[model samples]
Target chain A: MSQKIEFENILRRIEEISENSKKIYGAPLIIDPKTGVATWYDQREIKIRFLISIEKIKRFFEALSRGKILATKCVNTGEIMFPPQINCPRDPKNQIEWVEIPNEGELVTWTIIKVKPYSFSHHDDYIVGIAKISNLNINILAWVKCKDPNKLRPGLRVRLNIVKREPENYLIYQLEPLEEC
Target chain B: MRRKVAIVGTGHSIYGVRNDVNLPELAYESIKEAVDEAKIGLDDIDLVVVGNVGGWSSEYLPAIVINEYADLAGKSTFRIEAACATGSAAIKTAVDAIASGEADIALVVGVEKMNESLTPVVVEFIGRSGNYFWEFQNFGLTFPGYYALYATYYMFNYGVKEEDLCLIAVKNHHYASMNPKAHFQRKITVDECMKSRYIAWPLKLYDSCPISDGSASIILASEEIATKITDTPIWIEAIGSASDTSNITRRKDFTGLYAARKAASEAYKKARLDPGEITRHLDLAEVHDCFTIAEIMAYEDLGFAKRGEGVKLIREGQTYIGGLIPVNLSGGLKAKGHPIAATGVGMAVEIARQLWNKIERGRQAPIKNGRGLAHNVGGTGHYAYVTIYSLTKPRG
Candidate 1:
C-alpha cells in the first residue's frame, strides 16, 4: 500500500507540465496562468547520500547490534554523555567508559509527526518521544510506540528497547509506555 | 578600543513564494534599496557579507553570484550560515570587520530562495539541520516536529492548552495583514487557526511560518562614516549569541530554549541593561517565531514572562501593542515570513525602520525607549542570537 497521493506524484505532475510548456515555449519555462508569473523549471536534480564517518565511536554501533544502548561516562568528572563521544569535552585527557543506558526512563516530552519529510514519506504518521534516564542524567529521542497520544503525557514512565526497524530492518531504539506494555 | 558600528541603511524584499525573480535579482532588490538609502554607491562598500543556506536553491556559490550580479565583484565577499540565523551571522561578520578597522563601510545581505525546489524537498532539507546522524538519520525529526516536542512538554508541564498556542498565530496574522510585505495579508481568527490541519501534533500548519523567498540588506559603517552617511542611524547596541548541543536528547529541559536564555542574558549584560526587565528597556521585539511554541518560549527566554507564565502573557495579549511590551510588531517570522537566511537581517531592517518611525502606519510600535530587539534562533535553539538596536549612541 502507498499513500493516496505521494509527493512524487506532484513532482511528476510538474514534470509533465514543464514538458508540455517546453514544447510550446522552447524552454522549460512556466507561466503561472493564474498569477501570470513566469518561472524557469530547473531540469537538473541532485540526489544526496551521505557516508558519515562513525569509526571513532564504533562501539556505540557495535552495542546496538548486541541489543543494548550505550552512553559515555567521563571517569574523572562522573558526567554522562549521550550520542557517546570518543573524547570528553571537559578534559580530553580524562578516560571514558561505555555504560549501558537504563531501559526504563520517564517520558519528558513527545509529539506525533503528522507531516513527515520527503525521505520519510513512505511511513505512516509516527510518534516521537524524549525520555530522561534519571540515573545517568541523559535523555534519548526515539519513536514512541503509541496510537493514542492523548493518553500520553510528560512524567509518564517509558522504557527503551532495541528492535529491528521494519522495512529497513536496522537496529534502532524505541520508547514504549509502561501502561501499554 | 573597538569602534562603534551603526546601520546607515536597510532594505527588504517582499516575502513569499517568489517565482517572479531569481536569487541575484532578488538579492539586488534589497541591495539597491540599501545602497540608495545609505546615499552611497556600490563602489563605497569595502566588504560584502552574504548569508545564504543553499541546498534547495540552484546557486551553489551564492555570494559570488550575488557579488557579480550586484556589481560588487571587486569587494571582499563571503557567505555565512548559522542555520536560519545566517542573516545575523552575516551582520556579525560585517560589524566585526568595521569594528576592527579592516573596513570603513560594509554591506551585509541575507537572501534565500526556498521555493526553488518543491515543498517536500525543502521540508526534508530543513529537517536535517540539527544533528543529522543521531536525530534525522534515525528518528527523522522535521522542523515542526522538533518544536512540537517542546510544545508538548510545555503544555504538559504548565497546563497550556492548544488554544493558547493558536492565539499566537492569530496575533501574528493580525499584524501581518497590516504589513504590506508580509506573506499573509489577511487576518485570521483563533478559531480559524485551531481548525487548521496539524503539521506536527500540537503544532498546526497556521502555527508554522511559511516557506518564504526573500532578501534583506543593511549597510554598516563606523561612527565617523555613519555620521556622514545618514542623519538617523540605528546604533548596534549589542549582539549576544550562543549555541547548544546539536542533539535534542542531550538537553536537560524542553520547556524553554537554554541557548536563547543564555544569549539574552549576555546581550543585556553587554548593554548594561537588566535582563529581567527587558520589556522596560526596548520598545519592541521581533522574536524567532518559526512556530507558535517558539514565540511563547521566546517570551520566557527573553524574560518577558517567568517560566510557565508565557502562556498567560499570550492569553492576556501582553505581546500586542498597548500591552505590557509589544513584540513582533512587524508580523515577525511567523507571518512576515521565514526566508531562513533572510530572516535575521529582515528583523534588523524592520527594527531599524521601526526605531526611526519610518514603517507602515498600522504595525509600528510606539518608540518610547528609542530601542528595539531582534531575537533570531536557528535549528531548535541550537544557535541563538540576540541583537539590540538603539537610536541613541551608547556610552561606554
Candidate 2:
C-alpha cells in the first residue's frame, strides 16, 4: 500500500476511538496512555486545494506538451526567467520574449525525498535536483531520473527533457543524467 | 533621536510535542509568566504583537484568541509571519513601537501549535511556504528537501563528510540533555546520528529539528518605562532584517544565505562591533539551527567563520563553551525543538536568562562581554533577522 493509504488507516483508527469515546464521555476525547492527558480530536475536517491562475504564462504549458521547455527572456535587460513570467520586474515596459531552455546543463545540487508530503505520499521516492544552464547562469529545479542516486554528484552533466508524469498523467520537465565526458 | 528600547521581562514554554494543551493555553503559559515577571498590569501594555505561522493550527486568528484567553482583550494587537523567524519579527515590531514613542510598553509573543495537525499535513504546509507554485507544486520539495540541496552542494564543494554534519547533531543534543525544556534531552552519539536514515538525501532524520508546539513572550519597554520596571533590563542594541527572492532558483549560489549575511552586517554596524572580532564582543549566540547544515552556513553568514570554514569550526568544537564563542547553548532548534514562530522569541529568552546567569549549569556560557546575538532565519533564508541584546544601554 502507498504511504497515503497507511496514513489514512491510522486516521481511521483514531476516528473509531474518538467515536467510542464520544459515546461514553459525551465529548470527542481520547486520553493518551503514556501521559494520561485528554485531547479532543477535532471533528471538523478541511481539505485545501488552490486554483492558481496561469493565464499570462499559458504558453509555457503549451510548449511543454510539444516536448519543448520554455523560459521568458526580457527584451530590455536580456535576463531569462524560468517558470516563465510575462512581466519583467527589471523592465517597466513589461517586454518579454519566449526562448527554449538550453537542454544541456551541469547538475549543481540534488536530494531524494524519502519522507514525502501528504499530497506526494502516493508516489515512490523521487529525486529532485537543480541544474545550472550553461552560459545562462540561471538554475532550474526539477525531478531527476537516474539509474542510481549514488552516481549523482555536483558538476555531472544533465539534459532536460519533457515527459508525461505517471498517475497524474501530466506533461512536465525532468532531468536525465548524461555520462561524464 | 530614537528612544532606547529594552526587554524587561521574558518567558518561554517547554518546547516539544505538547498535545496536552490547546493553542491559546500554550500561548498563555508564556504570556502570564511575562506579565507577572514584568510586574505590569494588563492595562499598562500599550500593544501586543504576536508572531505565528498558523496554517497547521486550528486557530485562524491567534492574536485575538490569545488576547481573549490571557485577559488582555481590546489591546492594540496584530500578528506577524516571517516563517520560522516570526518571533524576531514580532519582537522587532514592538521594539520599533517603543523606540518611536508609539508605546511605552509592548508585549511581543511568539507561539506555534504545529502538533495540532498530522505530521504529513504539517509537512505539506511548511513545504509550500516558499514559492509554492514554482518550487513545491511539481517538485514536491519538503522542508528538509530544500536544505538537503544546500547540504549536498556544500558537502561536495567543501569536502565535508556526513560525519562532520553528524557532529553538529551530537553537540546540540549534548547541550539539549542539560536543558529540561528541550525536546530531546537524551544525548546522542555520532554513531547513532550516522545510523539514522535519511529523510532527505545527505540529511538524516537526526539532522532535522522536530516539529514542536511552544510559545515565548517578552515585555519590551521604552527607556523611561524600562528603568521603572527592572534594574537589569536586557537592552535591544540593534535589530537588522532583510529578505531574499522567493524562488531559490534566483539565488546566485547556495553556499551561504546572502540575506543572513546582509542582516548580520547591518546589525554589526549598528551595534558598533567589528565583524572580524565578533566573538570578543558577544558572550554567546543563538543561531537558527533548523538543520545541521544550516548552523554551519550561519557561522559563515554571521561572520563567525570565513566562507568554507564553518565546518572547520564545528570540527574543532570552537562553538562549544570555553571555546571561541558558545552558540545555541539552549539546545537550538536541532535539539530544542523548533516551534515555528516561537523559536526567535525563545532565543531572546535564552539570551536574557544566560546573561542573568540563571540558566542550567554545564550549558551556560561564561558571560564576559554581557552581550548576546540572535540569528533567526525564516524559510531557508527567504527572511532573515539579526538582533543584538546587551546588559548596558546602547550608546548613541
> lDDT of each prediction vs. the true structure?
0.91, 0.93
Q: What level of docking quality does candidate 2 show?
A: high
lDDT of 2 at A18: 93
lDDT score for residue B237 of model 1: 92
lDDT of 1 by residue, B45-86 (tens): 999999999899999999999999998997898999999899
Writing each residue's lDDT as its tens digit, candidate 1 over A1-181 gives 3332577787787788899988999899777889999888888777789899989889988998988899998998888889888677787677899999989999898888878888888888889889998888888899998878888877899889988888888999999999863
**How do the residues A1-181 of candidate 2 rate in per-residue lDDT, one tens digit apiece?**
8779989998998899899998999999878889998888998987778899999989988888888889999999999888788888878897999999889999999999999999999999899999999777789999999858989988999999988888888888998998732
Clashes of each: 0, 0
Mark the 10 consecutive residues where model 1 chain A has the least summed lDDT.
A1-10
Scanning candidate 2 chain B in windows of ten residues, the lowest lDDT window is: B245-254
